[model samples]
Target: MRDLHNRISSPSAARRVTGILAAALLCATALAVPVTAAAATTTGTSDDATPQLANGLALTPPMGFNNWNSTNCRAEFNETMVEGIADIFVNKGLKAAGYQYVNLDDCWALPQRDSDGKLVPDPVRFPHGIKAVAAYVHAKGLKLGIYTSAGTKTCNDAGFPGALGHEYSDAQQFADWGVDYLKYDNCNNQGVDAVQRYTTMRDALAAASKSTGRPIVYSICEWGSNSPWTWASDVGNLWRTTGDISDNWSSMLSIFKQNAPLAPYAGPGHWNDPDMLEVGNGGMTDTEYRSHFSLWSIMAAPLLIGSDLRSATQATYDIIGNRDVIAVDQDSLGKQGTVVSSVDGRWVISKELADGSRAVVLFNETGRPQHIATTASAVGLPGRSAYKLRDLWQHKNYNTAGAVSATVPAHGTVLYRVSADRHWASYPPAVEAGVSEAPLVEAGTPVPLTTTVTNLGRTPAISGSVALGGPQGWRVKATSPTRTAALSTGRKLTTSWTVTAPAGTASGAYDLTLTAAYRSPTGDAARSELATIAYVVVPPPDGTSYVSDLTWMSATNGWGPVEKDTSVGESAAGDGHPITIGGTVYAKGLGAHALSTIEYYAGARCDTFSAQVGVDDEKGANGTVAFQVWADDALVASTGVLTNAEPAQALTADLTRAKTFRLVVTDGGDGGDSDHADWADAKITCAA
Candidate 1:
């Protein structure tokens, strides 16, 4: 169970075999066990037998709280803690807040089951039996969730009286004990396809749940292996999407950020588990905890709190119980957040709500603070309409009448819920200016000059002075912004400068903040898009003719270029193995810098050349390359270079199309390296 959150790259050895053989064998074996259970109502092929049953449990996002983070098998389970936590839920009014399930994680089961092959509760610890404990939990108007595994032993090495061979009987026992939820884990289940194994347990639980007239929620505990998102609907109500999250901001942010891309897979019933909430775990501050809550909500993951409820402080209650923030998580539309933009390790994620509002999060994963400006369009909101924004965490409202931008704090997040409004023209205009390309001084190479700026507003942007600013020592004269003082509305202005790159301005892209701030006709001030200029400073160029691994040539003793050459003749395009040129090469016609058949028959002499080559210029005819044969300065036979842009099939040395000829290449200097006049895999066809 401890590995419950550990990420797995592939299925355990056991799961792979099970995926191959379990379907045909499982039912044959389960039926022979003489277990009376309900048959699957939703019929499908054997591999998908449990789909309907699994879907039934995951029909809605699984909502609840888990107890592993706050207390990790501390041997501290007792009626007092359980009841206290349950009482706290009622007192803090969280049950009505949509936090219902109170699950007891690992370490609750006794060492063995009864003679009838049923899991037995430890009499010393649970004097009233598990049934009575479950009843007490139910009496408090909450459901009970228990933990088990698919192996021969529990995560704690407790005898696995509830797995594999005992699947049916154990399921019946759990139903009889009033269990409402089952967390089928992947721990200790070696050499089995966890997917099918977990599915088997789910089917068993479904059978038992049907028999006892109870609907049990089944959870798959495989940590992101095989990317359960693609198969979660067939597995269980919820699936763990990442490794275990710890009680630290780094661990929490890392896990949350990883889940941002996985939001599309999360919807009603199925959820992405970001491990568990570490709010009251005594490791992070209240602000960090708020961020944790905000990110998880935006990701649309389950809100299974992992902190100790009984000992949680007032601040913990406020962070977790904030209804305004929770509204974003419980959004009826169920769309998860997405990373809209990223820079310098910082990311901006946005989620759309059912009311057509949007939730935006600016997360700075780095150590230092950064000034980040994002438009509504960047977060899926079009500027055709404006919106009123509410900072959910700050509990304040903002007027984003036109375009909105914020200077995000360090290692923090700004969560906003924006609603579209018609009165967008009332707010002041925000002016922004940035570099088209951050000027990079390649110690010797000249930089490409270009600049662009967009209004990004419903209205046009007024003209202003856009300047490039950088730290003192590394500025380039040619890389400076032009001295334009005025720009027309919604139009952009471009200018250029020339500066010599110093010896050491670093070797990577440097930031050049482009500022274009100005005053409106009403004497009010504004700014443009905070543009980024990339200044690439490289060391002196290495002027050697070094060949690249992907380069290919069309001449004798030539290699193919990957970026230019697609394929030779009908040989198709790709990285063909290695072509060795150690003999005289002959060409029948000019090649279009594609894969042409260049041949040296198995045992033919080099002088008797009979190689057929074809060029495929897939992009309609333009600058076609013609083959020219030269024996140190003598022109041999030459065919009118074909300029048709159609792809050519493998050309054989048939007399009608090709005659006995030698030497091959594109005409002229072959258009230099810029013009692809190279050959790949020239081969001579033989009557094999």
Candidate 2:
């Protein structure tokens, strides 16, 4: 569904400072909504009454690929892409790992229906027609899914025909074309009741299935606005419990917090979907992607791949293709995980498996390493003296004396499959090790790095040693005692090292590895490794310079890649036009959408930052946004609310002795529909 239209702001200039202060207060506290035990499990719902679809499909949450998040409505979302995905699923290990469906999202149909009241596939996109594409997918032993809305038109701005009044005909058409799945969206519904609208399609699909003997999996994509999870259990196989998902930690974490509480609503045939997967998207790090996948699996959500599989990396495949994690999602118990305990930002979630076992996750949401600990009894397990722990990511087995703990990295998750089998003497020690965040430093500067190792096993780890390794041409020396005495169970050893990069090292992110080695009580050697990143920044320029000319330490956008000197376009890089604000084009600036942040290395040399900011004209009179400038973590300046109806407004901030400078743009209390923002004539003045 699209966002509501913008509300105009007061033209009073005095409200600018007040708005800035208010927004700063909101930014400081709004995003820290905590997950608690009170909302962990569902109440008032009897387990015996959980609704199920009689169709018998989706006995477990469906695992498959959807081409919406990566190539939504783009030219590349054609017959070739769909067939290629099926090929990859067959050739790669995905098919063997239980991923079956190959789905296509919106814009697959022509803008207008045929004269005979039938839908037509876009000839340019599917030259061979829909039936031929379905045949190709079926030949590869995979099912095919198609997308449409229940309204008069689809969600995309192109206004493709929907299945509103034509449900029976459209259902028959899809069944005749061999379509195995249908993702029905909610858009432009013209104020109709949600239950009535979805039920109409449900009956239509059932009738079509009875006539044609072909069952199509129904996915209700009402975006949780109507609380689909509470009633759509019999109407659809899976229903989205949240809005669309972006490829960022904040977005993923927010969705997880929203979906994790609805555990009781998910079952074998009906599920609570949280949009789609964004594993291979470049917006977040690999560690964060792993956490995303783990949380989704523990929730028993649908495992739909949302990336371009033809161009994905090995790391993406490794995270999504983990059969161990997939098994947890497909467990016969059909139970979603609930939060066992949550303190500060560390969360412990556990799900009961069908085989008298538990799937536990130690999730860290903070920006630093944390020691998250739980117990077998707390996670709803049998009170065994010892348990067999299998690390899902590491794919290793260990023994623990009822303690389920780990030093989880920032935005990382430690998943374990715990069984009550007591094989403690045969397994090695379970040591959870991680390093702290490396400080941002200039080239040739020495910085201290720390690593902490903890023993969570039944026996002690003997002769433990920790080492930190840096990139090539860098020097690493231990600053503290590297060797430790016998670390008893639940004990920790912290070590530090001083590292210096070469003088000529370029400014960018560099990789670092922290290794911890120890021996079990039986004198068996074991090693644990954690990978981290360090930043090397260049000094600020000596004179006034355009901000778009300097290198930024980090940049994150809402829709697509941050443009250098153009407006924020769709998902592709460099697809934007010139930086235009209210029809006035600027020569140099940074262009980004709302919910964006760009960080620069001010290096304490920058004094003044100034820019003319407004909603970009590329989106016409359709956007509303606000801009803010931060020196270090303090808000130095802000634009109250600039809309596409208004001209550019000047903004300046004092950056005295501030090491980091941040540029932020947010949707002005509305949603981020067309909020294309620009920092026109953005410049930084520094001391020479």
Candidate 3:
């Protein structure tokens, strides 16, 4: 289990085949793991099975402290550590914030079972036995959670009983020991189907709880290999939705991106896990940890902290103990939030709480701090009204009209609760801005922009008029739907603008501002609503057009996403060497051995093409990275391998007859370690 956090992505060849087949079939059926014990429950479907028998358990996500995130199967898990965890949880006010259960993950048992074939705590690690630790936790008003594998052996190959053929007996043992939770992991099971193997344990646990009257929350750690979200809801309280997450910003972002799509699968009883919270692990900064907490809260993930509570800092305690953020996770609505929008590396996620308010997170996953802004419509908020927004972290309140905006630090997050402002004067109308074309418009191109002023107020506005403005030297004109328009309640007044930048305008974000005024029913001047929209301007697509600014790849990320950036950082943290040439940023993306697609409509006019590629790590990095060019999906040229320590490599491909080409970046094998890839100064020469 050493560095098992990264092993989630590097599955064995056998797992790869089975994973693809299982994923392709979208299999939801679990094979029945038989139990011979008379008191054990047998096999059944996920939905009407054992969970209903144990109703209303884990009604909200279980808040607890688990050893795996901090110790990683490395802790000397004797009675002392368990008691210490409970003491910390109580003394540190974590229990007040809903963090209960001291969970011991993996490697607590001896090398072999006793003569009776029953699981026993290792005498060396637990001289007083498991019951003593449970008693201590219970004394501190906390619960104890035990760990087991679904396979024949535990993850550490400790030769511990995985409950394979002993589900009934092991469940009975755990219940008798006063365990309140069980983290059932997938380890060396010799190719057992996850659904069936995990299901067998679920049934046994239910039977044990029914017979012994000891309720245990079941957590299946299958690592999302079989799409556990499709069926794990009825089997366990939570299921791992992706590979293990390391205590790094990149790893956290990667897991969050993977788990965002499975939001609908999560609810009151089941959640989509992105592994454990690596808060207070010393692997990331405080800002990053806050972002981690915010993302997890917005996602409604289990807050099973993976940290050394005894040694954690005050900031860590504040982050993990934020009751306001926790309220969103344990919101009665029980809905998980998904990524609503991504702009300039800024991601917006919105979750609806039970009280009808929305928990919104503005996350910046970029190297540089950014002003993350979006229209109410983007977050599915009522676009025609004002929202009384509260900054959950800062404890500040804002009367936001129209567009919601926040300046977030690099790899930081801003968490807010958006509620309807019932009072019209307090929550006034707002103006929203948009453009007809993509952010990147060719230099000198005239783009049509629109701004809508709405009464997000309890009453209507009299003599409403909106004025639009943009940068000087750009000929800008505007027209309102109706000048001096008297807007009715929830009615919108529309305005449009046509603006053009000079031919020599630099290509980047250009802001367009708006000022709207209205009179109150009493004929007095009312406060105005203002907004700003940032639109990107780009030069005409020349022979070697940069892919980063291209509409096809810029805003998106992941499987086929691409970014135009010059930072050599393995991650967006701005690491490595300055590799960009004659520009501020380079086109960067990642691939999982498979090609991350980059479309270049360079056309047939290109006579020569070349690019410099390298792994974006401090030189000699172990992970392999490569760049490939494709003509109509057919490989043209590839810069075979570039390790982090190596200088950027150059590649040239034939495009005499090709009009469209794709740029591909690959992990090059050895998993995605240091696979921070870069296509620095990638350009093409045209027949001038």
TM-score of each: 0.56, 0.82, 0.64
- lDDT per residue, candidate 1, 1-688, as tens digits? 3532121223342342232122213223432342222321222324644455444554445556777776666766754566567777778888878777777777676767677677776666567877887888888898877877777666554444437567777777778998888776655565666567777877788788878987788777665654565676565778776545666554565456446656656776667776678787766666568778888888887788888877788998888898787888888887777767776756777888888878888776533334456667777776655566666865744345445445444345667786675654443333334343334355545455444443434443444555555556654454545545544334556656553445655544344555556544444566543423343432221221111211121122112323222332211335432221122132222233321222111212123223333333431233244554332223444444444342332322222222222344442222111123333343333221
Task: Give the TM-score (vs. native) of candidate 3.
Answer: 0.64
User: lDDT: which is higher, 2 or 3?
Assistant: 2
Residue 90, candidate 3: alpha-carbon lDDT: 85
Which candidate would rank higher by TM-score, 1 or 3? 3
Query: What lDDT does candidate 2 reach at residue 131?
Result: 93
Output the TM-score of candidate 2: 0.82
Candidate 1 scores a C-alpha RMSD against the true structure in Å of 18.0
The 10-residue segment of model 3 with minimum total lDDT is 27-36
Q: What is the C-alpha lDDT of each candidate?
A: 0.55, 0.82, 0.67
- Model 1 clash number: 52
List candidate 3 segments past 4 Å from native. Answer: 5-54, 157-159, 376-384, 423-688
Ranking by TM-score: 2, 3, 1
Off by over 4 Å in 1: 1-51, 54-60, 157-162, 402-404, 423-688
